[model samples]
Target: TLADAIFRHLDHGAAAGPSLAGRHALVTAGPTHEPIDPVRYLANRSSGRQGYAIAAALAARGARVTLVSGPVDLPPPPGIDVRRVETATQMLAACRAALPCDIAVCTAAVADWHVANPTDRKMKKAPGATAPVLTLAPNPDILAHLAAAGPARPALVVGFAAETHDLERYAAAKRVAKGCDWIVANDVRPETGIMGGAENEIVLISADGSERWPRLTKEAVAQRLAQRIAEYFSPDRSPA
Candidate 1:
């Protein structure tokens, strides 16, 4: 298989350093669109840049990457298997299909709820007419599903928490609630321009404690994360 061939080449030619040569990584990125009607849907400001960068970085470290992405304008990263999805349910399914992976990173800004009964046609707004009521239901939690204890669960699971206030507290709580190994939390307040922006400021919360990272380009963050992942998997290194 092409994937096997690529890993074989990586394993043979890699320099003396941390290498994921034959590891598999599953990553989810972008914002899910929950349909309200045929023409309208709920979404957020995720550009998928950070997710894409992470996928690329992992691949650079010799991990075979499967990027499950939501609708976004960015081109697919080279040497990656990209699975495009439109809704949270679809994203979850895609993630499940890429199972038995070594690492799982849930970075997509999936909507928490979706319209339970979305109309097939475009909803029209008529003058002096009552607005149509949309029944709402919770979307499937992809991070929790991936982090759940099971034979198929990845060795490492990371979740992202984009928040407005009390970032660290909320992120720490989320890590436990979702059963993920780490939570990368960021302030998404409009003024911060972190969401849909080129740079990010994050606090990486894990059982060991929180590590505050200075604001840096998404690519830099991805590289740092990929390095950390490699270190975590290194045979000589102790578990964090």
Candidate 2:
């Protein structure tokens, strides 16, 4: 009953105004794993909390939510459809398959590079203690691909910028480079704990400029982002 009530309120809040009812929202979450060997892999520290919460929020607001996640432990949200993938290539393929949505949120911290070819069997270490060399190749940029996917591109394409320095400067450049409608930028420094922590601070970057958001829990950020997406998709809303 509680979940039902909250959903009802969200529906009313979105629909009473210019809402995203009947629109499809696609979200990517977690970190893609690149296999090195049968027993070893490469990945980041993404928890997928923010992205999953955003999917839940969009679902609450009456959007058809499609979550393409990469090995998250959390269960799928109440009213969202989820597709799981392990590698960056798989994630891109899934996004292509789920194209033409009203919005696409690229929240996954996909690896920039992956092993050219993973060994089928476990790699044995040398008795002399010399480390084995691994060759890496760049992975496809899923967010950039979605934004430039011709007519199938969503009305609003959003990307996440996890940066270490020059926060807004790099974020703005990333937004322009990715060709997305918005980029949610964050500093993942040690104290802030943006990677694996529950709380986060983000700045919204768009064509006009940037807006620094207050520190909040992951759930709150999702709700706020969902609301902004709803407004942005409305017939009367502008980039402003």
Instruction: Write one digit per residue (lDDT tens) for candidate 1, span 1-240.
Output: 999999897764343358888999999999999998878998877999999999988888889999999999999998999999999999999998999899999899999999999988989989999988878899999999999999999999999999999999999999999999989999999999988899999999999999999999998898888888888899986444
Give the Å error, residue 144, model 1: 0.3
Model 1 root mean square deviation, Cα atoms: 4.5
Runs in model 2 deviating more than 4 A are 1-17, 238-240
- Cα lDDT of model 2 by residue, 1-240, tens digit: 999999987664443345578999999999999999988999987999999988988887789989999988888887689999999999999998997798999999999999998999999986998898889999999999999958898988999999889999999998888889899999987778777889889999988889888999998898888888888887777673
> What TM-score, computed on C-alpha atoms, does each candidate reach?
0.92, 0.92
Model 2, 190: alpha-carbon shift in Å?
Answer: 1.8
Among these predictions, the greatest lDDT belongs to 1
